[model samples]
Target: MPTALKLTTVQGNSLPIPGVESWHVTAKDPAMLVMTDFHWHSSVTVSENSTIDAALDHMKHTGVRCAFVIDGKMSAVVGMITAYDISGEKPVQHMRLTSTPRNEILVKDIMQKMADWHVANLKDIESATVAEVLKVFTDSDVTHIPVMEKNANNEQRLRGLLSFAKVKRLLVA
Candidate 1:
């Protein structure tokens, strides 16, 4: 009061509160990270009968690590192909089982069979936290799960995908 009344001598007007040291969000943090295909997906696909070379080429062209395999002209997805499958000789191994040449291998050969593929429901995903999504990855062998959502007609259709790629990238970093 004496200093202020006599002269303009205020040292600091703001409280000594802590300021943000860094503003970065990582996957390991407990974030309410609800996500879907609409969040970060850019995609490409191949027919089940499409050649592995073609699938690989498609991946290369589109900068996608994976591609979905669709059934004959139907919008139904039959399987999926990933860079790991190609490099790990999975397609060649599948071809070997059927006595097919390596060059002739197709998406159907190495693709994760629809019966074996794991999937998630959009409704459940909507409320699931990032931790839960990470648990899904930790609890399953599948690297990705296609998400299905109910349409206006109440028919469930492919709407999104959750991949281990994000978890891998984050954890590794």
Candidate 2:
């Protein structure tokens, strides 16, 4: 008759291997998983000629929360402003749409200056892991991160944008 193999128990379960230790391994998805193959272009942009009211109107029409202030020269990415910046404090009755035109109020007049904003270049973003992105979101006040890339001419171009919402979803997923 064949001999029966002996079994060992741990926490009321039989061990797969007798006299060998068992371990539980936890795995995490890397930052690459969060990156999408199809880039979602952020069309929310305005020129220096654009007024606060016009920008706000454009934002409302497009359902975008923020607008990027752009100029033809070098794509400096001067600044960005949101609807909350305008309406957060002012009451609805006090908010002026028609009376206060956009041309009259240049984007620079209302945009949160670059000096006051936190900037993260594309290289910086590419090097940053999902955990680092989460740390940035938790540590900073800004919601959007501008992703910059170098063009064929070797000039920096604004490639895309990263939002806190996307980062959070990726981390949790």
Clash pairs, model 1 backbone: none
- Per-residue CA lDDT of candidate 2, range 28-138, in tens? 444433433125644577775676677788889986667778775736577777776555533232336435443466556667766676656666666667777667778
> Lowest-lDDT window of 10 residues in candidate 1?
27-36
Q: Residue 114, candidate 1: how far off, in angstroms?
A: 2.2
Which 10-residue window of candidate 2 scores lowest in summed lDDT? 23-32
Q: What would the TM-score be for candidate 1 when compared with the true structure?
A: 0.71
Model 2: lDDT of residue 80? 74
Task: Give the residue spans of candidate 1 off by over 4 A.
Answer: 1-42, 170-173
Q: Give candidate 2's error at residue 45 in angstroms.
A: 0.8
Candidate 1 structure quality by residue, lDDT tens digits, 81-170: 887787786866777688888789877878887677787888887777566787888987777777878889999777777667754554
- Per-model root-mean-square deviation over C-alphas: 10.8, 14.1
TM-score of 2: 0.57
* TM per prediction: 0.71, 0.57
Clashes of each: 0, 1
